[model samples]
Target: MSAERTGVQTRITDVAALAGVSIGTASKALNGTGQLRDSTRQRVKDAAEKLGFVGDARARALSSGRTYTVGMITTDSFGRFTIPVLLGAEDALSAGQMAVLLCDTRDDHVREAHYLRSLAARGVDGVIVTGRSADARLPIDVSMPVVYAFTPSTDEADVSITLDDAAGSALVARHVRSLGRQRIAVVTGPERHRSAVRRADGASSVLGSHLVAPPLFGEWSERWGRQAVDVLARQAPDVDAIVCGSDQIARGVCDRLRESGRSVPGDVAVTGFDDWDVMALASRPPLTTVDLRLEELGRVAGQALLALIDGGMAASASVAPTLVIRESTVGA
Candidate 1:
């Protein structure tokens, strides 16, 4: 055996040399392809292991003509809602033997465009764009199959899967109404968000002639919830119930209501969207919230990506949101 030299970099050649075989034989043996003696394969594997040799993913993709990476782009606000969606998408991707490349656009077209270009350059097999809502224009030049989860692309060309907020919000409204509260108030994210608007619309359709607190336009933040309720308390003094766009927002609303000397469901009932488990565990009285089925959103998107990769036909998909009742709003 030749002695190792100082400052000499190692390569496949070095593995082949140490294994006493050709570079092609070393590659075949390590990759477990082509016919080779079992002992010979073991020798190549041990040599490569000792050398800490690993193949380049990009190189492998180029050679096979299938980049195993899929692009996932989302908005900054999506963090609260997209956790399960991403989890489901990753699960589906892993099961299908693919990798995910995540990017946050923060609801900016310029940033979204940059990521789209980068993902295309990387030759990703497909792209999944999770929107904060279904009211933004996607740059239409992306070459790979694109799937929109929870947020549909402005162009109808892209496949979309979203929570049926219309149904979910209406259900929440009915629950609030059945409690015999005629005066209702709502604090939601932004009117520009199609999901938020849809939720408001659904709630309105159910709670006719009820005073809806002026729709608060803000990001999905606890502080927004606090501020929204503070304003609502003064504007709609007779308000009997408060509905929040998300659970985090509900926490703020509940806290603000308490600070204002109002007892939850005793003075003013509070309800929220997004059945955030962590919030439910930490809140004083477990929050009554709606489950948007985020993981299912991810699962559907993942399945869609696989279908696209496998040359399957195009089809639209959607999932319904469900309400989870708790102490904050009713049955206290």
Candidate 2:
């Protein structure tokens, strides 16, 4: 080797020599890819670790033309409905042996555009758009494989896995109906939200022939919850069951119903979505809700992106959502 080549400081070649493998093999194994045997991969990893060799991600990306880093663009920061999803996506990506770059736009179109473009510029292998209750109209066309989890973009060409609002809402209605509550009411978010509309449709379908006032529409906030309860009280005093779009709204409904001297399941039953009691799991009277399978959505999104990266075909897929019954909606 030339003097200049001999003076290179990379330990990858050293690690490869120790592992009895080619430098390219060491590179692939350490970078978490290639068709190497399991034992060879482990040996390469161990040797690299022992030699304190960190594979250069950029060089690997350049050689393979694959960045191996996935980006996630969230409309909101981690919240009641989104934390599980973020955690799940993180877990899934980590298991895939890929790095994550997170961007929070807080539902701003301009900021979202900036982040999306920035991620694209960085050469992310794929992107997962997470948890936006509003319509997502990204300004630029993304060149990377894109997956939408817990939220769908306005463009139908993008892949997505969202909570089955119809299924969740129907579950709540069925539970309330099982409790024999003849009068039902709904407190949901803005009418423009696709989720809110689907949940309402699901509830209406399941509560056939029952008396339900027009749904009280508002933001997904505890304040809206409190205000909506008051409005419902005046507008539909005879409501026997109330299904909230979210756990926060349900908490507001429960608090107001209690203050108004209504016994849960006796006078009015309440239910929520996103299994809101992740905070108060130890509480005696916890909330009832729907498990939107947020993390599972992450797993599916990651799998789809990986498949896309592998040049495998993928059809638009759906994940199942489940309901968790708790004291909030059950009888006395």
Candidate 3:
């Protein structure tokens, strides 16, 4: 009655027949290739499931001339940012029945080179390069298609997906301004960091003369955020809002503000970038911040890389940020 019981392998033709589509269409649907409607793809998949059909990896490789695998190289050893990106990529790649090989370079050039050679040797179809920072880096020397996530490729021609840092920072500035916070101060990470510079510039562009003082550049840590409050007291004692470059910094600012008998939102509204749950949600009044949507960025990068692997053109793109409001900016 069934292919398993009859000792016959269930073929794509059987699936096509059951789904009322041509063999080519079925192949395309199963292989995640060609343009097909969602309903059509679902029909074919359902038919395959009913027939207990399993595509053979060896046959697929032979027919497609691909190893059905991709490599992800990340320099973020702690996986703070890279993990979400990797998870999003996996979600996209798994839909096409592709596997991912992770390579952690730990910011070592020698180790990175080794991993590159190793991925090449293993015949990975493509590589996705990512890092904790959003700064651009030199493209990896590879013949196959490559996509950069978070850390963009320096080459304009390469396919890179990165967060829109300036736009995100602008959102924060506008949010604070909308709250009638006239005296605003920005506190962020190192001045040399591209993200910090972009965020500061974006907020400056929006707040303009309302920006009470120049952005305070320091470490991307709670300590810096706490210390910044003291400086703000002396520099802009009447500051009504503090825009932080990171959720960690915002949490620190909230804590310090509370200790100083200042009510969050009532006395000093605060905003942060990177809606990191651990910091954003844990803050005294919760933080109103810009969500970078790193996972979505990774999904886009994966889709772009897949297109490139499928003989599509390469292009660089940016993902817009989302504004997440909380009690920090608006009273609960």
Candidate 4:
């Protein structure tokens, strides 16, 4: 009602009225919350933009007593996969005009509980929980909003955004198949590893008709890769493609195949997972891999948590893997 509450030329009501939505809807749209349809959200945003309306984050937080800070917990701490996810979450939160507080639990439940309590006491508006892999972990039984990044919660209802390992593996399988290779086989991590099983399931679903041998389960090391290569040669001597569950395994396969008087892509086409550049590029002819899009995963998690904090519906999402082609599969 007062001019002070309304800006000199524009007001929240003006935005809402122009967008054909309620004031509450306008507030949620500007605040980056309230699960409006993309079209609706865009309309609201366009209305605000045309009116030159700017909503101050600090002012909204002060008026609503909202902290505008999101808390993130990671089990793997700064492990290779976790950092990129964390970075993505940070970028997304910052863009939403929020801050993030990170707690590294190192896979300890006690420490995780302590951090959850501490974050709640600090009044974090929401929480993002991530892990090194996509395996489902137990939920953080906090009262506030929570989003799992790159890790699903055992509670099926909880919002989780994860990399589609099955999709990634199938992508590699199809790529190798497209290269005119019929006898495809797999070498991957331990059988107990969920990532390994999921990846195997994915590849097998697509390559069932073309598989020469079953996936060889082993550790996530070059030594295992080397050993598996030898084993597969005997089991399926005519195997023309080896689809590794990881870059490490693929690198090892590449090494052993060459040592055994086989040429990569000439005799066998090798591919791996996780598009981790260090290993992919350093290999003899570089590696063809599936990029899990870890950064994008984290970014989506961050945005989802923020939206839930703003009283929106839970956002559960899955990202498809991107196939990165290189000398190993394409042939230089």
RMSD of each: 6.7, 5.7, 4.6, 7.2
Q: Assess each prediction's global lDDT (C-alpha) against the native.
A: 0.81, 0.77, 0.91, 0.89
Q: Model 4, residue 308: displacement in angstroms?
A: 0.5
Cα lDDT of model 2 by residue, 21-81, tens digit: 9989988888778798999999988887666665677787898798889988877776655
55, model 3: CA deviation in Å? 2.0
Candidate 4 local lDDT, residue 320: 90
Can you give the TM-score per candidate against the true fold?
0.72, 0.79, 0.87, 0.82
Q: Write the per-residue lDDT of candidate 4 for residues 158-203, one digit (tens) a residue.
A: 9999888999999999999888899999888988878899999999
RMSD of model 1 against the true structure: 6.7
Give, for candidate 3, the lowest lDDT window spanning 10 residues.
1-10
Model 3 segments more than 4 A misplaced: 1-46
Model 1: residues >4 Å from true position, as ranges? 1-64, 75-78, 104-118, 211-236, 277-280
Candidate 3 lDDT at 288 equals: 97
Kindly indicate the candidate among 2 and 4 with the higher lDDT. Answer: 4
What's model 4's overall lDDT? 0.89
Report the poorest 10 consecutive residues by lDDT, candidate 2: 276-285
User: Which digits, one per residue and each the tens of the lDDT, describe model 3 over residues 44-95?
Assistant: 9999898888778778887878989999999998378898899888888877
lDDT of 4 at 262: 95
Is 1 or 4 the stronger prediction by TM-score?
4
